[model samples]
Target: MRQLIFFGWNFIFNADVSPLRHIPDTKRRHLVLQALGLMWAVSFGIALGSYTVLAISVLGHAVLIAAAAVTVATYTAAASKPHLFMSGLGRSRDGEHD
Candidate 1:
């Protein structure tokens, strides 16, 4: 248990696998945006399930679902192609630093 806790803490604070280091610059932004979209989708599903099971506040559940949807949409769009609004947000493809 102690070792597991230490490993978790280290992983959280000092991650060894940096996406920038592991993934090529061309695909790094796409990968990050895709991951963000996936996370939002997961959150949406979890919130829906929780509301169904716990019968919690409908307003809160709706808000969570809406937020997740919007976030996922934005991330998906950003991942699909480069846009003026999201300029300077992702890694450069012209051998430029982010």
Candidate 2:
């Protein structure tokens, strides 16, 4: 949660600073979220294996899959165009249209 908050803050504040910043922050956040999702999948998969119960572990795995899917889609989308996510960090050129 804390890591997510930090990522959000960076996204909100630093996104417009540069294309490089946009690429790294987007990629890093995706990676972090992916790791967390993997942790959930593995932990619950193991729990389900040992107990033969299909409830808690199933819920956990579903959550994991959902998180991973969302992040992957988001990152892929962001990888295109990019200026959408890099909305604020640049100095405006006079009379230049974006």
Candidate 3:
């Protein structure tokens, strides 16, 4: 059980061995990560009873908005300076390793 838990954790959190590694385009890979983050954040908020059929509370809305803002900011940063996010990946614009 412990091994299974550890594997799950790594599979979700470990970038070095992530499926993203196969995506040679750095921008595309980071974009995918950003999308995943946004989805996770929104899903987490929903799981915590943030959203309801009737209405959403101010705090819940604020949390979701903040998540969206962060996603946009990170996307902008990744687009302008992808090198900051490409530490161990070493992939260049032309899909060549540096």
Per-residue CA lDDT of model 3 for 14-80, tens digit only, reads 6666788788887888889899999999898887764563355766788999999999999999999
Q: Name every residue pair that clashes in candidate 3.
A: none
TM-scores for all candidates: the values are 0.32, 0.33, 0.40
Q: Relative to the true structure, how large is the alpha-carbon lDDT of every model?
A: 0.70, 0.72, 0.80
Q: Candidate 1, which segments miss by more than 4 Å at Cα? A: 1-24, 56-98
Clashes found in each candidate (C-alpha, N, C closer than 3 A) = 0, 1, 0
List residue ranges in candidate 2 displaced over 4 A.
1-52, 88-98
What are the per-residue Cα lDDT tens digits for candidate 1 across 1-98?
Answer: 99988877555433243333444554665567578669989999998998787765776799899999999988887788657455686678788864
Please give the lDDT score at residue 17 for candidate 3. 63
Model 1 vs. true fold: TM: 0.32
- For residues 9-53, what per-residue lDDT tens digits would candidate 2 score against the true structure? 665455454233545578775566567669989998998787876
Highest lDDT model number: 3
Instruction: Name the better of 2 and 3 by lDDT.
Output: 3
Against the hidden true structure, what lDDT does model 3 obtain? 0.80
Best by TM-score: 3
Better of 2 and 3 by TM-score: 3
